[model samples]
Target: MEKPNSSNALVCELINKGTREWNINNLNSWFLPEDREAILGIPLSSSNTPDRLVWAETRSGKFTVKSAYALALEEKVHNTRADCSDESAGKIWKTIWQLRIPQKIKHFASKAARDILATKSNLAKRKITPNGMCDLYVVKMRKQSVICYGAVIMPKKFGRIAGSGVVIRDDAGEVFAALSKKWKSPLGAIEAEAKALEAGVNFAREVGIREAEFESDSVVICNALQGLVSPPSSVVNVLAGIMNEVSYFRQWKFAHVKRQGNVPAHLLAQHAKNVEDFVAWRADCPSLIEHACMQDKM
Candidate 1:
């Protein structure tokens, strides 16, 4: 057979033509010697099974837009490189891509890798004048004492219990406090989110913050907090608790934000799964989440 290209169709055709089995004898005739060796190295099932496609880039063996983008970027970089032998950049990309966090977080990280973000320093380097526009300026001016806090919850899965993370930051986007806790029992995502909000309120109260703004990725939970919708029975008690805590604040608001804006809390929630109990940091953020926090500030 002619040399096979790196196209999915070509790979599938080769596998299909080999009687749908990956044994050495069947694949040897179709693949080049190196490719045949690689195929043989993969462990095949003893029982008869149909062939299936797997995206080697992801642990789930499923295709994702992020993976496709990464593949295309890798090809572009390879073609632009002088030697094409150094893989340091590829190794860094793989490390970030393999993170177990949400896909949106990974997508943002990928953009950071490409230096696409237009930070003030980057604009200066490009000799472009900054508009001096700030998205959070109005909110900062309205409530000098107002602090924004993000809450996220990771539902129990793969033998892990529900985990919640909360991050509190000042108007200057500096972290004042953070929390991570793992629930003993499994809770649905909405319920866990409500719990996280409640925890955030309690933390704010403990810190004696009179004005606060709570943010969450879950629109349902944020709406319930804003009285825009009635919360389900499962989270009614938690909602009530959150409302009571809200009374402690002189002024407070709940806002629904996209996942990209809530990466710090999301990272904390995922980190909570591995810990045995809750953890709190005061006047500081965890080293592991510093990168996400910097991204948010940018």
Candidate 2:
């Protein structure tokens, strides 16, 4: 048999089998305090739903422009207040984001306002200590504009198996597809996150998306996808699978997001625990997650 990808014990595999209880020996053998406690805390599922793997994308599994725009606005707002204590400055974010300008330009404007240019202090913030100030650096235009938002739910109070969700929105920020998937075996949170992206990429490819962007709440997974960092040893295989799928696309982007910015996908991931039949939605929002989808537009 192939070696298990992670050193951690699989949640489903740790059951006492016929006795239907946790295998305490394996739990103790495999996990540290927090992980063990979290594993033990998983609420058993009454539905006994089989695990699922579903794919989707627009542009989805949303972590990119939306989150970046929000982050930029947040940073701009915070910096303005810190520098001047002027309440009026708080509206700068609103103003920048609300501009009639193109989305890309507005994002750039936000970055400029954030003082992201490598000035002496900014370089110092980066630990670069450069002697001088520095400076730095869509699509099918629409159809090709695929961005992904992906979220993962740990095995906690919800259910014994981990789950993940992906929502692929169009360039207009309208949801075009959604999916909630259960991991085949118990997976670490990050591993499940990588699984979510893998699902999104497969979805994109299935629908003949030649170019796409993907987003996730896990910075490690995003960084690995973007080649910004080496993938962790435990998730190497999962990341590898994602990269292989990504090769099919003519273009692709990876981004990191905070949990709040990824709420819809997070909700879908949480929904996975109770879904009786795994299915992917198209051209419509799943009612349970519809409100969250609408909220993403604002």
RMSD of each: 19.7, 20.5
Per-residue C-alpha lDDT of model 1 across residues 1-298, encoded as one tens digit per residue: 6443322225445443333334434455444443443343233222233455556544334667987887677657645652324599677767877988655456555545555344534433322222333222211000111333333333324342456677778888898888776554334345556666666777778777788877776777778778887655445555766776677789988777666556677677777777886888888978978998888788
C-alpha TM-scores of all predictions:
0.48, 0.50
lDDT of 2 by residue, 220-298 (tens): 7778778887665445555766777777889887777566566677777767777653568888888988897787778
Clashes of 1: 0
**In model 2, which regions exceed 4 Å deviation?**
1-146, 154-159
Best by TM-score: 2
Worst 10-residue lDDT window for candidate 2 reads: 136-145
What is the Cα-based lDDT of residue 75 in candidate 1?
54
Off by over 4 Å in 1: 1-158
